[model samples]
Target: MQAVHTAATAPAPRFALRSSELPIGVVAEQLGLTLRAIRHYEEMGLIACGRGPKNVRTLGQSARARLAAIADLKALGLPISEIADLLGPDGACPDRLKARLRAQLEALDARRSAIAGYLSGL
Candidate 1:
């Protein structure tokens, strides 16, 4: 006799999310970031999020780490465009970044030297 299958006997579909992966809402709350900002980052290609069950956005470990780095860069006053270029598709800082960093460092040193000179003269 053929075996009978019923709804009760059918296996429930499951979303195969790894333990390290989190939905966007959970990630935003955990990271102390607003959902809008997280979504903006997603749209900017700064962090890649995978589609979870029911099309929910899920961020894996690397994407979460990237978001943390993005937050740090934002805190350091780096613009989104520059951050995007710095963390581009290759996921490595390009050679031009070294030049940009040097330029920024030189400007900062110049400002610091000027401030010190003013303080010394006063």
Candidate 2:
């Protein structure tokens, strides 16, 4: 026998998240982070949230997207401080990022030269 599913019999989501919002747990799951990490991001002023029922933090979709970018930048080795500057309203991040890349390359070249000098002395 083929079982028919009814709307009333459907399982509800764990939270009553609205279309525009995502609960903090879900947001953290999406970003592959722990609740503590999500809260740290908020404390770092990199993202903002709203208080839901019982004062649980709820983040909107935009905030979630921003957090995703924060994750990506952090993965790319940018400290939270640098990520904040790149995400700031006044930031020209593409150009700023190019400059940062060039600086990193120069630093790496200097490190390489120092390593070569050390090896020559050995």
Candidate 3:
């Protein structure tokens, strides 16, 4: 007796991301960053951009991530050199990265506790 084979099912369709080709103003607004700050990051090589025929800057996904990272690191009071080192490709890690982040969190918590203690005593 011969056995029958079953047909395979088709995969589901993927939803495409809808992002506009944004200018600097639009990007600044979307990222909640100032135009001057974005320019400074670009100048520091933290963010990359493509230049149009008229030298208009166009940012890509990597640039967006770098910009966000820079903003976060700045808010955490990290120096630019340290942020650049942290964002470097060779510096990306599976173990060391987590350790570094934990250290930063601890430091932030300690600072917060100190501030709270001072406020409580005031």
- The residue-by-residue lDDT of candidate 2 on 14-104, one tens digit each, is 5565779978998889889889988998998888988776778999977888888788778877787888776755333577776875887
Q: Give the per-residue Cα lDDT of candidate 2 at 116.
A: 100
Give candidate 3 regions above 4 Å deviation. Answer: 1-20, 90-97, 116-122
Off by over 4 Å in 1: 1-13, 29-32, 53-55
Tens-place lDDT per residue, model 1, 11-115, is 656876778889999989887888899889989878888888888899998899888877766776678789888764645557776677788789989999999
C-alpha lDDT of candidate 2 relative to the true structure:
0.81
Could you estimate the TM-score for every candidate?
A: 0.71, 0.63, 0.63
Ranking by TM-score: 1, 2, 3
lDDT (Cα, tens digit) per residue for candidate 3, span 5-82: 545554533532235345676678887888988888788777777654356676766677667767776777778777
Task: Report the CA-based lDDT of candidate 1 relative to the real structure.
Answer: 0.82
Name the weakest run of 10 consecutive residues (lDDT summed) in model 3.
Answer: 12-21
lDDT (C-alpha, whole model) for all candidates: 0.82, 0.81, 0.70
RMSD of 2: 5.9
Ranking by lDDT: 1, 2, 3
The best candidate by lDDT is 1
- With a 3 Å backbone cut-off (N, CA, C), the pairs that clash in candidate 2 are none
